[model samples]
Target chain A: MRITELFNDGQFVVTAEVGPPKGIDCSHVVKEAKEYLSGIHAVNVTDNQSSVMRMGSLPVCVAMKNAGLTPILQLTCRDRNRIALQSELLGAAMLGIDNILCLTGDHTRMGDHPGAKPVFDLDSVSLLHTVSQLEKGVDLAGNELVGEAPKFAKGAVVSPCSDSVDAQLAKMERKVMAGAEYFQTQAVFDSEKFISFMEKAKQFGKPVQLGVIIPKSAGMCKFMNNNVAGVHVPQHMIDALAADKERAKAGITSVEIAAQIIKECRPYCQGLHIMALGWEDKVPELIKLAGL
Target chain B: MLITELKSKEILDSLTQGKVFIINCHGCKEVSFPEKEAEEFEKALGDKVTGILTTDYVCNIDNLPLRLEKHAAAIEAADTVLVLSCGVGVQTVAEHLPGKRVCAACDTYALPGHQGVTPLEHECDQCGQCYLNITGGTCPITACSKSLVNGQCGGAKNGMCEVDPTMECGWERIMRKLKQVDRLDVLKCPIQLRQYNK
Candidate 1:
């Protein structure tokens, strides 16, 4: 079933992300998702996330689907031009995939191959618009498709913890106008700020899934504070993680913090999107601890 | 104004291997030319440098031909002509001196100001569709790293941009400006999808 159906049915949707391996063999990630993420509504397969080269999200998503897991295909405008992007959308539909999260991917300079040419022919908003157009059986050039048009439960991302709330809201409104049925925010750490952002975001009338990133270590929190855009790991959480010097107990501490954040944000959002960046083993515990 | 920085010494060295004529433009109003750096580079080049001709406003198409004519001897003697200026200056030199192998000795980046005129704290990308009327004087296309038209991308920290921490977030600046003018409601008017064709 499409994620939108879950949202419409008033079920508190739960999703997680799985980064495809850089090599062709994705059995490890696929097996990991099937084993650990069975309770979640769907899994998002990132497309060359952080601009690093990896196995395409499409094939990995197919792998996930073959494994009896629902996969949300994450599409970015950084690698492909309009033609390639449209073609990929059609291909995903042909393969029975229905969910897409459109993003204006991280700049190429931030990736492994800085010399690679970035093809951001369409930003996130335009790409969402393109998705809506394709659903109507027309291509970007106004040409009709030869076969049945592809349909998708379109989604987009927003950053609620940004310094500028109004600017983020304005963009969220645009995303809604461009046909984003749902939104998964950037990793949010501050509950009070998120509550306030949700208050304003409620006006958009779209289901917003709060993004929760599992903080693996205190050093990881600090790194995210400095490097990750729109992600601010509060000092208290850092101190909490830092207090657990014993590496054996770090996973327990991480899950506890993630659960606490989920509980705090549960009242405001319609769903939860956990990004356990390589720490997928702890997700089952996180879900249980959060009482999901 | 166009902010320019000198290319790395290694790149300059590779490009300036042959006898080269240098044409440096000091015409921009407020843009700082890397004169000291260029001087050091020329000194390092020593015998490889055929000649140096410093001119003003090399981007001026009408005056460029006369300026190149005056330096014809030095330019003819050199195998390569190195133009130290913004892209416009280098292109002008290349167009005028098509026979010579012309190369740019600097990389140019945009500043928050009009090109070839008085430098201000704001810039216009000339994206044709002006958003200033709604943005309250701050240009999101020029100010934001991703050039997001609707608003902030949620990557800002303490008003600094996610792409470049040194720079202020464009949407933050726009919001502050809008608030100061009591026009924050303008951001809620409608969805704005940038027309790339425009």
Candidate 2:
């Protein structure tokens, strides 16, 4: 099913994101995509992504589409200027790429090189506006483009755990006003926090896709706690798993800590964007666990 | 909270082509904490983050030369390493894995056990003989709650310190405990040498 069509019925969605490798290891990407295609309505291929470059998202997204699966094109404003952004949307339209997820990716300075400069020429909001412009048959500079424009059921990311409800929902409202038809939220570990956040998200009236990334192991929960911000995996889960480390004598695989979260938060989310990273094949097991 | 690199997508993207990176940490407590902090630091490090794995553990000093040979698969998986072990271990890891970016993830202040969390700013300055006994086993320079030299400062309010309401005045609590235990006379004894020789 096309993701746009899937959202129309809006029962429960299973979308996943695939990170393309920089090296010519399409073998892993292809294998992972095939694994994802069975249970997911659509798979998004991230662009040069967090500004740490990769083989561009468009080619792989088109490839996924070729493999008889819906693909969401994640276009970021980190590298490209407005000219590039508008042209790509039009190009995506030409290529039958209908689902566009717009982002103002990570700044260049945060990557490997500290001395590198940043290009924030267009933030995510402005990028959302640009996508709307393409839908409206115009360019970013207020000039109308020749011929028809591309139409996409655009979605923006909302990190429900990052800012205050007002701040996140305000952006959600703005993105919706700017033609964002859907929202894919950051990983939702605490369902109560998201339920409260959704009370505010309801004003925008767009579908919300929850980002569900299962932790790899016990150390990962602590790694996420100590490292990954915005998403808070409770201290109890980490401490519990750390305690269970001694129970390798039992049948408990370390990855089971993540499986617990899916069981916990399944009721609160509309759908989950399972990002199993390297463990893409585990998608089926997770979906089965969720009873999706 | 300690940031080695800030966020920038442009730099992050360019560095993805960089070779995989790894750091070995041999499961020591100090290395474990710093390794976590270092990995978090690496995540904030926009790009060029290939892979990070803290080593299994180290029991003896001599375990390096031969066991490091067994780490050929892990060593070959990266182009750089920020060793989270002490200087000796860093040198040991680097001595074997030549021509790789090996830096210290842990600070040089190698101390034992629970008290050393490595303050970004030094908390104490030992000016020779410690006066811990005079202040009830709490050094004025390090543990007076406010480092008040002569006595509890005005911030010391009614048994508790004002700077942190939960904390009793370092001097006040020390004095009360000594009096309660009939050790008030011991308050006059000067502290024994507490200079951190290392």
Query: Which candidate gets the maximum TM-score versus the true structure?
Result: 1
Model 1 lDDT on a 0 to 1 scale: 0.82
Instruction: Name the best candidate (by DockQ).
Output: 1
Q: Candidate 1: lDDT of A227?
A: 79
10 residues in a row with least lDDT, candidate 1 chain A? A244-253
State the C-alpha lDDT per candidate: 0.82, 0.59
True contacts kept of 1: 0.55
| lDDT tens per residue, model 1, B92-180 | 56556645566677766555666675223445454544455455555677787777776666567777876678999877866766676
Off by over 4 Å in 1: A247-249, B1-123, B185-198
Worst 10 residues of 2 chain A by lDDT: A247-256
Q: Looking at candidate 2, what is the lDDT of residue B133? A: 28
Which residue pairs come into collision in candidate 1?
A167-B152
The C-alpha RMSD of each candidate to the native structure, in angstroms, is 15.0, 23.7
